[model samples]
Target chain A: MKTRVETVAIIGLGLIGGSLAKALKDNGFCREVIGYGHREPSLRRGLELGVIDSFTLDLDAALSAADIVVICTPTLVAAEILVDILARTEALEQPPVITDGASVKGNLERAARSACKEFPPYLVLGHPIAGSERSGVEAARSDLYVNHRVILTPVAENSSEALALVSDMWAAAGATVVQMTVARHDAVLAATSHLPHVLAYALVDALAESDESDEIFRCAAGGFRDFTRIASSDPVMWRDIAIANKAALLQAIDQFNEHLQQLRRAVVEEDAAGMHETFTRAKQARDEFAAILAEREQAKTS
Target chain B: MKTRVETVAIIGLGLIGGSLAKALKDNGFCREVIGYGHREPSLRRGLELGVIDSFTLDLDAALSAADIVVICTPTLVAAEILVDILARTEALEQPPVITDGASVKGNLERAARSACKEFPPYLVLGHPIAGSERSGVEAARSDLYVNHRVILTPVAENSSEALALVSDMWAAAGATVVQMTVARHDAVLAATSHLPHVLAYALVDALAESDESDEIFRCAAGGFRDFTRIASSDPVMWRDIAIANKAALLQAIDQFNEHLQQLRRAVVEEDAAGMHETFTRAKQARDEFAAILAEREQAKTS
Candidate 1:
């Protein structure tokens, strides 16, 4: 049941919003796309690229006409934007089906529930887990979300039509839609994504300020190059992730710390046998992980 | 000045030895190449691949007619083999210039000085810090050393001719030869290479044996994959490295621990500002590192 979402409003034309605009418009997945950006230059760029049918910073004009509104602001400001939109639009006879493209969901849920108490319910939570280290509207591309996972966490007893429309939207953008609870999503991402970033940051900090920094950096090989590539990602974005997924990210950090301490103990004690066993287990685990990735890749190709 | 060497003996047909054999023979850098591998299959493979002109299990036969002998075994076994070769060929009228292609240099220097006292007057320590994750003679290639660094450490009163010959061999193999003190090399590698391997191994070990392993791994993206790729490297080899460079590696571990503690404190306190600062510094450092790598790549292409 594909509902006709004639005019889709995309708020905050940064990387995610700008990309969505391009992907949906270029693929002919949407009829007319409306865009709202904080900066005038980004709005102009999106318009020049034909990613949006029209653009404005006027929240009322964008929201009143939208059949489907997609919020794509920074993580820290996502809640505020949603609350303001819901509050100001309460007098309207009919409101758009609201969906947010924020990474985290728990805070968004609270903000939405508080602001839209008496209004027609129209809220969907989604996280598109795809990106490049290069960011912003200049880095926008239609194929960024192709073959990536886009997890949607809809509230219980929600409008099935709205959910279907949101699912179709992501599917049209070339993403696989998987549903999960907000808590589960945060924990999984903490272990898989956030922890790696934290460790990479720590490793770089450990080496950069050291005495042999120049020598070690000069001789840094291919292994080091790939391992630290993600450490160059936008810092403020990671800072928000660490705070938003505070509990799970802390658990992940603790787990890695324990592992590191054990390795250090092995080196300190010169326990060759113990160290060898640890390495063997690590090797086996990586092989298994690689196999899983290979299967996913094969599936995509096929 | 290029020095003439009639025969070169490489003991061990694994990645290092087999690669050195191929590079020397393919480029006509040496008159004849002979090898000794612990495994029969590897010896056969090396001969079949033309990495060695001939090979013998008898150690003396491999070393008797050699003008230059390269011991390319694991670091743990490197000392013992160098000692055994010197004892067997101590009575030679004119011993060949001896060099061992080992990662660690202090132990090799001590062993070479102690064992070859009655034998070769020429001893030099060399480390060609270039290789792929793949090991064994099958992975050996003539271009393994191209555009890579080869560090040389010469002891007090070490033969200038021996040092010159070894340097020229590596240079002819397309490596940029650099000289460093043994202690400095160990310290530099400890921070740049050893610590990262330890962190990668620990991170993999933390997840490989857990119940949440499947979920954690499923969500892992490109960053996690690259960071853990080196965790799949040979355990025995890494174990030897951790043991041989214990002191320097321990210092590096301590430094990394301090950084980890800082991150832990920030997370525990929910200090977003602190975490952002740390990540910003790391991002800048990685950018600088990437710039360096890109410059080197550009130089290679041009």
Candidate 2:
């Protein structure tokens, strides 16, 4: 029989942390899920929503008696929290197996390694690839990660048990756990996530500043809404993500620019053949992706 | 007071035509909406679904008896159909004023002017800025144009009665009609509509062709879905639009490429300040657009 983790300490009850708390609570995976937030209002709201059984603002108090601690703060804030946890718990012989739920992993992994010298081999890096445009505890949902991919990038020589625990926790919460190198994670996200946001933001800016701005807005339909919806995302969070994944995002942007130039050329030359090929390829890719997702969904139901 | 036309003719029974037929029928704007489709199956399905009161394959039968004619075929196909109509009705004394429903106006306007020389003063061009990814008569909805924009691009010296009749028809079907020059309409739509579809199709294709195809598919969520939803749109239809609006689309794509390169440079050089400014401007633009939409929606409800 698998041992149940009775207590989980979730630091930072924002969208991610609050979601994890709700998922853990609903699954009956943890008997007590505690939430810690910087502000009193969030802590109270987290409790009120039943995302967490208890709440606190003190990191030491929040971490002292926990079986597992998941830090779900902004990337830089997560790094600072990891350092603070290690500094305070340096004297303890038995510190919790800590993993962070930050989007970017490379920087967080390096910071975690550097701060926790005696590292219980406890630091398992994870990113639950799930979110909403609406933020905070109120927007958190228990099924946010259901059937979603949760990536684990454990450091070399990390304890196998800690890794399994993190993987199993996400599995229990209904995510498909996959393992990859931290660098690969960042690189992949640059194309799939980060770079798209940059493009969406930039496209919105270009159209808004143009002389035909009002006309563009007036004519925008569902397509425009879908393309620019992400621009409504938290600017600060996006800025942090952009800075953290700078290298990979820049590379992705370069590839996109080249492809975009080809489109421009085809358009300028009024090359029907080239335009047909470009849109045809895009249509095929999206259809194939939709097919894969639909297959997975079918398999689960069957 | 606007004349209440008892009979209306709708050519082509696909997504747009079918939806417009249903909208007009549901709103009780006309006694009957006659449809025409070259394909027997589409004609049968449209009639059975009540998307059209009846349909005919005979070209003259479809056009000669109707009071108002709405050409809802593909842009190029619609242009071809306009020529056929003009050739058949050349000897008619009181020909019905023709209005076309195509995305790109300049090309269609030119075609109308050339083909309908005998009925010179009776052509008005319109575009209902509303649609869905799903195609065919099955996807038709009566409320498809609810609170949507319908842009009218009447050529200079066109009859005011013709423009008023077209505008009133759309307004009665629950749309806000706006007027613009054909050149301005094409340029605005190139930025707001065509560029988005092109980029979406291109991005998805680029990712699918890469070795990281499976990983990209797995990581795609709401953002990817939203970004590439239009990529799954009718491929032939998009190809036609891209070709028709090639000039403006090319210019927009070039502008997007320039903006993308600027973003790439900021990321590559780790220019945090520059990145912040870019993101902030994009955010402001998106927010402003959203605010405008919200205001318009509020006005409609109020």
Candidate 1 segments exceeding 4 Å error: A1-3, A89-94, A110-121, A157-159, B89-93, B107-121, B270-273
Q: lDDT of each model, Cα atoms only?
A: 0.83, 0.83
Q: Per-candidate TM-score, first chain only? A: 0.90, 0.93
Q: What are the per-model DockQ values? A: 0.77, 0.61
User: lDDT (0-100) at residue A35 of candidate 1?
Assistant: 89
Q: Which ten residues in a row have the lowest lDDT in candidate 1 chain B?
A: B112-121
Question: Candidate 2, which segments miss by more than 4 Å at Cα?
Answer: A25-31, A48-50, A53-56, A61-63, A89-92, A113-120, A292-302, B25-32, B48-54, B88-92, B113-119, B291-302
**The candidate that achieves the highest DockQ relative to the unseen native structure:** 1
Model 2, span B127-189: residue lDDT tens: 999887678889999878889899998877678988888888898788899999999999999
The complex in candidate 1 yields a DockQ of 0.77
